[model samples]
Target: MITELALRRPDDWHLHLRDGAMLQGVLPETARHFARAIIMPNLVPPVVTGADAAAYRGRILAALPAGMTFEPLMTLYLTEGTDPADLRAAAASGLVKAVKLYPAGATTNSHSGVRDFDKVRGVLDTMAEIGLPLCVHGEVTDPAVDIFDREAVFIDRVLDPIRRATPGLRVVMEHITTSQGADYVRSADRDLAATITTHHLIINRNHLLVGGIRPHYYCLPVAKREEHRLALRAAATSGDPRFFLGTDSAPHVDPLKECACGCAGCFTATNTMSLLAHVFEQENALDQLESFTSLNGPAYYRLPMNEARIRLVKGDAPVSFPDKIQTGAGPVTVFDPGFPVFWQVAQD
Candidate 1:
């Protein structure tokens, strides 16, 4: 089936484009499909302040291939000592759209994340007052919590009370992977939403360890079981505006990923639309694809949808994992399903 529809151009509410060469190489792929992306602040040393976010935004803009009209929305990384006034200033300045809260050791470059929820209350209150969203990693750092239960545990112990305490605070549960997480977002009355990653909808934990520990599939808030995958698929294609697309296309070099200390991330920016189309097709929800992929995100962020359109043709088209995408450290071969994606991006 070949269909060309003028669906709203989407924005990635959460994305990671590493700094320097990797940023230059991988950014164009995202810009080509997404109108805007809330650039993650987990770079080395991390984007801890408004100045850092602004500078990082400048780098992303400079790295874009000259004529592409994509905007990189900036975020501040919430650390143990992140100042309340600075956060308010950043939100007021409109340079920082959201503040990312990463529980210490929860994910990549997140060692500097907030160690305790209470420690950052001042900053959180400030964000709530100023109307900036809190983009969360949404996983607990407790080693005893069982790897698969981190998201659920975090929700029970931290997120729920935080939501109650800070009424009207906007929150995004980034790359959610559990039924509990999904239900929580779905039930929220305030400004709460979730970003579903393409990988989580298509793969599970077994997919990561099936053929041996697959580093490429090893992302933080790691892919869950088959049941959760089904839940994610349902949420993404259910035409629910609370659920939208955010590739979370984090990239890590080969050595970094395939080592004893394998880095946690997935580089799916290149194949995001293809994978999303594949999921929607499986669900027989092609009609709703535009809303999940393109419309919901911009609406939640209060940004205008892109007027430009992208045409995707449905048919067998090979989407292979590159042996490596050259990064500063080395090459990185992302984990791919190793098959032809029936939908291919033809125009944008």
Candidate 2:
């Protein structure tokens, strides 16, 4: 059996590092393993302008601890009133890697998201012309649609239409949670891809609901049935270039996550590499691990691969990670994979 493996450093295609205390506390968790990450723009006011992205990037760099290196690939939040000229300039200067599309009320802090697609057609055109990809949170907020079926519905009703309308617009469907999502990506020919979350690859809805309400398991585009999980596993382990790692490692404090109106997010940044190793091993496709976590993301975004490499070692005993990490705000729980994880990243 393979005991140790090394590969090029990985990049997170999707990530959430909230500003202020939370940002300072959680930024290292991801930077520790990932060389860079496509930072989510869904903040309190949102990163909507070139200046906003530049300032946010500076703040991220400022928060990063010394003796550690990590690059923040910034993004702009799409809104009806977004300025095409500003977005074009941001992309030209490489200050923004992509534009995020969150359908209004789709997930946490998404009230400022776009409600009318027509309004952003001009911005989309500018992006296509300049070769900037759009990172999308793919779930329709229609109350009538079943929560579980929202992803599939969004593909047919929203995603498909937008793609067809803007032929050259590149889109990365973020944290796809269903077979429908995987199939949709497979069916597409060009300028399309999807990001699979580390947590989704391990836990299904049962893990979230079987015993009691596991608030930590709750996340946007909530975990689906076991079959969907299996499908995602197959796609991820298949070495499909179109599918890559985007650990939407959203973190909310214990108080915010355990209360009556608990938030929807899974804090997986801390143990993502370990969990990915566990899942890939279970699929008997450990060889594909590098492609999923490291290689594929940069290729899709047209960026160069990282020169640094990380090594993972599998041992007889299970790895132990902190149950919760204490930040200035409060304690934030780590994602529990339920089963033992024997594989962990070897310390440098």
Candidate 3:
């Protein structure tokens, strides 16, 4: 049996590092393993402009611990009032890596997202011309749609239509949860791709509702049925460059997660590498881990791969990770994969 594995250092294509205290506490968890990350633009006020992304990048750099090194690939949050000229300039500056699109009311801090697709046509056109990719939250906020059906419906209604209208515009269907999503991306041309999250690959809807309500297991575009989970596992391990790692490792305080009106997110940054090793091992696709976690993301974004490498070791005993991360805000629960994880990243 193989006891150790080493691969090129990975990049997180989608990650959420909220501002202030929360950011400080969780930044180290991801930075410890990932060489760089496409930092989400969904902060309270949101990173909506070139200036905003540049400033946010500075803050992320400042928050880095003394000895640790990590790069923040910034993004702009799209809104109805987004300016095409400004977006072009941001792309030209080469500081912003992509632009994020959140359908209005789709998830946390998304009230300012776009409601009318037509409103952003000019911006999308500009992005295509500049070779900038758009990372999208693939769900519609329409109340009548069943929560479980939102992702599939969005593909049929919102995503497909936009792609059809905007030629050459690259899109990433973020945190895709259904087989429909997987099939759509598989059928699309090279300009499209999808990101699979760690939790979505491990937990299904049943895990969230089996005996009682498990709030920490809950997340926006919540985990789908067992077959959908199986599909995601297949896609991630298929050695396909279009499918790569994007933990979407969002953090919410314990109270915010366990309360009546709990927020939607999962804190997986602390143990993502270990979890991915476990999953890939289970799939018998350990050889493909590097492409999924490290190589594919940079290739998709047209950036150079990291020169650094990370090593994972599997031991006879199950590895132990922190149950919760404590921040000034409160304790944020780490995602419980509900299975013993024996693989761990060897420390430097």
**lDDT for each of the candidates?**
0.84, 0.95, 0.94
Q: After superposition, how far is residue 56 of candidate 1 from its true place, in Å?
A: 0.6
What does candidate 3's lDDT look like per residue over 285-310, in tens digits?
99999999999899999999999999
Please provide TM-scores, in order, for all candidate models, with all chains considered together.
Answer: 0.95, 0.99, 0.99
Model 3 residue runs over 4 Å out of place are none
Poorest lDDT segment (10 consecutive residues) of candidate 1: 315-324
Tell me the tens digit of each residue's lDDT in model 2 across 1-348. 888889899999999999999999999999899999999999999999999999999999999999889999999999999999999889889889999999999999999998999999999999989999999999999999999999999999999999999989999999999999999999999999999999999999999898799999999999999999999999999999999999999999999999898999999999999999988888899899999999999999999999999999999999999999888778999999898889889997
Question: Model 1: how far is 57 from its true place, Å?
Answer: 0.8
| Residue-level lDDT tens digits of model 1 in 200-277 | 988899999887888888998888999999988889999989999988888887777878989888888877887787
Best by lDDT: 2
CA displacement after TM-score superposition, residue 30 of candidate 3 (Å): 0.4
- Candidate 3 matches the true fold with a TM-score of 0.99
Error of 1 at 162 (Å): 0.6
